[model samples]
Target: MKFLFLICAAQGRPTATPVDNGTVVGTLGPVDDDVEVWVKEYDEGSAEDSGRRLAGDRLTGHTETVRVRGGEVLVTDGPFLESKEYIAGFDLIEAPSLDVAREIASKHPMAHYTGIEIRPLPE
Candidate 1:
């Protein structure tokens, strides 16, 4: 089994313009719904380590922003959307099977409707 973890560092490019147009002007495709384990932020040390690892484990230094495919819509200074549904990032961990994923997701830090979706990876 394989998994894809999507970490939303920052919102992607904004689709809407400043002209107060009623409609957004960018593309927002469907995200991988079968995501497991969501969190506001990871451990500080792990965060730093992940950043370092992203730069090929180079400790020299690198930028501090991560982008996602459909991240731009929900972030803004003002309330652009009606619902408060927002996503930070997701973890797609693959255990031996779905039951294992369920067990892992059940112990998530933020439990409840924040149920992690466990599914087979697309070919």
Candidate 2:
């Protein structure tokens, strides 16, 4: 029914920028190598291969983690977890099935360099 695509990339990677050829590069090579990466979510109402984009965008730099310990709220800079990678962006997609959702995620350029986590949402 619905899925959340967590677009992750290596820490400190640069944002997606359009090259001179007017192609968007998302943390890796050109997103328009042979098939362009669909940066947005697929349309829910249409079953067409090329559907309307629902909602998606690249996240800005910097992140914060908030936690409550000892009855006090604590806030810290950067992600809550320490690792070599971080969530670079996200795409909220509507797919007919998990298999199709995986297909959509594979099209992302970030999937080539890092990884994309697909989580299905409850109906």
Which has the greatest lDDT? Answer: 2
Residue-pair clashes per prediction, in order, are 0, 0
Superposed on all Cα atoms, the candidates' RMSDs to the truth, in angstroms, are 16.4, 5.6
* Alpha-carbon deviation at 88 in model 1, angstroms: 1.7
lDDT of 1 by residue, 1-123 (tens): 534332222244333333324333122321212121133222111332231111111021122434455656333244243433333435555445555545545544322223234455664
| Prediction 2 TM-score vs. true | 0.68
Clashes by residue pair, model 1: none
Find the 10 residues in a row with the least total lDDT in model 2.
32-41
lDDT of 1 at 100: 53
C-alpha RMSD of candidate 1: 16.4
